[model samples]
Target: MKKFIIAPSVLSANYMNLKNDLTQCLENDINWIHYDVMDYDFVPNLTFGSKILQDITSQIKMNIDIHFMVKVKTKNFTDFFVEYIKANPQMMTMHIESMNAKETKLFIDLCKKNNIKASLAVSPQTPIKKIIKYLPIIDNILVMTVEPGFGGQSFIEHAAGKIGLLRKIIDQNNYKTTIEVDGGINSETSKIVKDYGVDIIVAGSYLFGQKDFAQRAKKLAGGN
Candidate 1:
């Protein structure tokens, strides 16, 4: 079995003490940080951008897993992509619904040029087959267990099937790709995803909402 990674999403962290929250994760031996970049147009909520990401990464040396929740057709989408790429996150995931074939290839190529792992994200309602063609090229696939817009939602149980199918496809093709799941992930949901072959777990409210982040993180990572 693959060792599951516990990535605490900064979206649910206390904004005023963001640095402390992130540092706490590192202190607890958790290395991956899930950063959600939302542009009000694609999703209903708007989130922080590259400058903030740079600031956090400068202070804390953690593996940054950025999820881009924005529309590709937006006027400044490229600008946003370039700026984020400059931050040099370990991995970056863009929504499959936002880009077409050409745009997807362009995004993946940019990540390769910069030596950053590129990933495709699929919403809860999206079919698993939507990203099959790109599986061999991308480094990872982020399966959203809940709707993309907000956090603290219940896990969509049916998404587990998608995770299973993705794992089978990756194994059958011997692709060097990983599977990551985000949104509404708690201790229970973590088990479900892990059983289905999720390599990384992105937990927002469930991990950050409680006072004991380390304890929650350990549980989510399948540690006792």
Candidate 2:
């Protein structure tokens, strides 16, 4: 079995003491940080951009996973993509629901050219069929467990089915795509996601809301 990744979503970390919280996560042996990038147009919210990501990247040794929840619009989208590539995250994912097939391929190729592992994400309502063709090129697939844009929404129970279907498609194609689950991933939801062959579990409030982060990390990483 693949060692499941317990990636704490930085969106839920206290922004006032963000660096310290990040350092705490590192000290607790949690090595992956999930960055949820949202643009108000695409997801009804605005979030950190390249500058903040650069600051965090400079400060930590942990792997950074950038989840782009923005629609591809204007030349600015390409500019931001360049900035994200420069930030050099371990993985950079964009939503398939936001772009056409050609654009998705272009961005994935762009990430590959920059040596970043490219990923494609889909919302709860998006069908696996939308991204299945891109599976051969994408290194990972993020299945949103809740509607995108927010941090603390409840996990859509049926999202597990999406992950399971994705797992099957990946296996059938013999592709080495890492399946990731985000949103509403507490200890209980973690089990369901893991059972569906999810490789990375992105937890936000469940990991950061508590004072005992170390224990929370352990529980999130421990699956049946």
The total of clashing pairs for model 2 equals 0
Kindly give the number of clashing pairs for every candidate.
0, 0
Against the true structure, whose TM-score is highest? 2
TM-scores for every candidate against the unseen true structure: 0.95, 0.96
Question: Can you write out model 1's per-residue Cα lDDT over 133-173, one digit (the tens) per residue?
Answer: 99989999999988898889999989766999999999999
Candidate 2 similarity to native, TM-score: 0.96
- Misplaced by over 4 Å in model 2 are none
Candidate 1 least-lDDT 10 residues: 72-81
Q: Tell me how candidate 1 scores on lDDT.
A: 0.87
Residue 162 local lDDT, model 1: 91
Among all windows of 10 consecutive residues in model 2, the one with the lowest summed lDDT is: 72-81
